[model samples]
Target: MTSLNPRLGLFRDQHVVRLAAILALLLIFFAIVKPKNFFGLATWQSMAIQFPEFGLMALGVMLAMVIGGIDLSVVGIANMTAIGSALLMLQIAPVGSDASTGYLALAAAIGLSLVIGALAGALNGILVAKVRIPAILVTLGTFELFTGIAVIVSGGKPTSGLPPQYAEVMASRLFGVIPMPLIIFIIGAVLVGLLMYKSAFGTKLYMLGSNETAAQFSGLKTTSLIIRTYMISGVLASLAGLVMLANYNSAKADYGSTYTLLAVLIVVLGGVNPNGGSGRLSGVILAVVVLQVLSSLLNTFPNISNFYRPLIWGGVLLLVIVVNQWGKNNNLARLFRWKGNAS
Candidate 1:
């Protein structure tokens, strides 16, 4: 058994290997196609800037997925939170105001956004856990509900008149080249990774996902963990929304509508089991980086129309699904054969 353990470890860890392979492939492809652009610090910085919000959204989705659930409402929540921040900023610091006042207004806007996000998440959690509705149905309902509120509040118009400081903070370089958004993303990933991987609550989440009945039988608080997972997702989505507002210097009701599919793609591409119970943050981080690099590559190639991006993304998703199924089947076959031999 000990002799076979190392071989089993290799198979168990194949997801990690695949993630690294994808990243390496992306780097090689970018280097070949856009040598000059791909190697520049400016290009790297731009890629870093593009990641934070999408990464955060992906993180939220990953957490829900790990708990054997999904949150289709994250994009809607982000959009609504972004609009809420914009509206609050406008109310507190009209068209013109002193920089200090603008800063305070921004702070207030963030607080309001967080509160709104938490409420939305809580509602979704209650519907799923207490009301005994499937997460898919609950989140899908809120997706539309939140987006509707966002459109009504923004009047289908882009928000402007943001204070200059917002842009300065978003675009600022720390230590000469690190963008503020990238720094925020790193911090978020580290903190959330620790919470999900190192804490007792995280273990409970995995146990619930693996088998809710067993977790409950073992005296785990499954319902509370599920609710808390969604709540955390909501908070992270709201934070992403704020970053988007600051980075773009404008907000729109539909700002995050396109991110819904992207977030799911990242989670799946990261090798997270769709049926849940097993995954890692490292794979997710690599997947996000790979996708961002792919986006950058596509952006550099002017001839590759933006309309085709979705098609490419869809194809990649299909491939990932196929690969996951194949891996699972192979593992199951091996496990059964081993059991038969032991018998």
Candidate 2:
């Protein structure tokens, strides 16, 4: 019963409540402005299919943010993994292929990409943990290095010529409605949520983020833990790359360049502290839904230039940061408590 209360308290958390309210308001506003498009199956499908890539990236961001770190190299890691997978697929099946050969190639590509992702993560982890450099600096440097390698490997062109089975496996709808990418995203979310809440590692991570000095004094293996956390982020980023590869039928150096900002924004808006002591995967998942819906809404207006999106996202991020700081200064928790009492 006591445990249940603590869990219930999360539902009553100010951030969760606020996100729910904003999501509802956004839906209502869009529905009112574009009734037909907002309420359509196509819109919903687009939202479901598209958000997962960003969602996956944001989830990786959330992990780093949880540990009081950031991974700006996610975009580079994702592109590199996708390119590697493409190269593997081509090598496996060559020019023309049978279904059996293509499936073999797909399996090999997935395995290879995951390994590459882990290795990429290990590199970031070592620089940050072993070398004791600040995470932001380490990741930023690696981001450029990874991107340069990807560009050199692919010669600045998208890798296309994939086995037909690659697209077939990724594009097929699960249960005739849900996109496979969405399903993959949900699975990742669930695993991460459990990792953050139900695991001892989660507790240690929170402690480390809250106060690194204290964590080290308490005899926690801070370095290894940071390494493992970044490794997880890398794997998730690679998964995003694989999904993007399938979605577009190609892999490019510049793919999802805007994603890095959007991902950090998602993590921040999802209520992860920049100083990084507290956060929840549940909140991050809701944030994903909200952003996806908002993104799809932007697409509904044909006259709205796609270029406006980053600007809008940037503006929203700035607002959220300001509001977040204000809320902290103003004791917004007390305000919520007061409002709850009045209600």
Candidate 3:
């Protein structure tokens, strides 16, 4: 009992530890309830392939939240960048092109798409940081603007018939055991971790999020930091776009339309403070897996409709927020103390 107390205290204080335990419990529950569906390699592989799209977007959302801002335009940026990439692919390597030419075109399209994402993000930064508009209002307006641009560019239709090379490389596994999307997600997470944990930029970002006035008085370039943060987010969103284009073998204006809400939910569920200045990348990553597992668990129930997913997600988000509020007030710890005494 004495030994267990330390672990219990650790779990109480560490968001990542709590998230990991919840993830484990969820996986075990699913396995028990639907062994045929959840105990197989196919289920896990499918989750690995599918979650990276929105998981990357969630990371972008996490960055924005960390800096005391929000980016509602991530889905819009992702879809728009994908649409642009698809259009570029059609022009550079039409059907009947050789595989080498298709690969070259794919590379060029990815670069250009990232550039577009950066520019779009920069625009949001300027509106929020320089124009003195609220972050929520700026991103809300740009969300519609970017989505509108995507619709116009794609002519309100799915852009398809691109070279097979894009999907082949993106959807293909490296060794027939691991997934390509999973690999890309790992790389992206690593880069973000380094940027946030190992650099001066990350220090400045936390400072700014904690108190913008203090940061400004301390001689930090608040505007530039905010702009760069959003730029990184845009790049991440664009990367997700490339992955989406590969996964679906096409692009559209409305792909992953529900992801904006999902991203915010994931960030908050990961124990990120919505008001900003405190979060862990590990917690966010774990939350992504936990949500994916939950989603998969839902799919195992044939009677459950897909439309209820958003409802479930919203409920879970609200519960997390309520719990976090309790934690902030130390009420959650008091409840734990009461339980411990009763035990």
Predicted candidate 1: what Cα RMSD to the true structure?
4.9
Task: Give the winner by TM-score: 2 or 3.
Answer: 2
lDDT of 1 by residue, 1-343 (tens): 1111122354356666887887899899899988999889889989888888889989988888887889889888988998988888888887778888788887888788888888888888888888989999999999999889988989989988887666766568898789888888898898887886568877777777777889999998787888888888898888888888878888887885668888888998887777768777777888899889989988998898988877888888898887677566487578778999999
Give candidate 3's TM-score. 0.92
Worst 10 residues of 3 by lDDT: 1-10
lDDT of 3 by residue, 164-259 (tens): 888878889988978898999999999998888788887787778888999999999999999999988988999899889988889999999889
Each candidate: what lDDT? Answer: 0.82, 0.87, 0.88
Worst window of 10 by summed lDDT in candidate 2: 1-10
Best candidate according to TM-score: 2
Please, what is the TM-score per model? 0.91, 0.93, 0.92
**Clashes per prediction?**
0, 0, 0
TM-score, ranked from best to worst: 2, 3, 1
RMSD of each predicted structure: 4.9, 4.7, 5.0
The model with the greater lDDT, 1 or 2, is: 2
Model 1 has an lDDT value of: 0.82
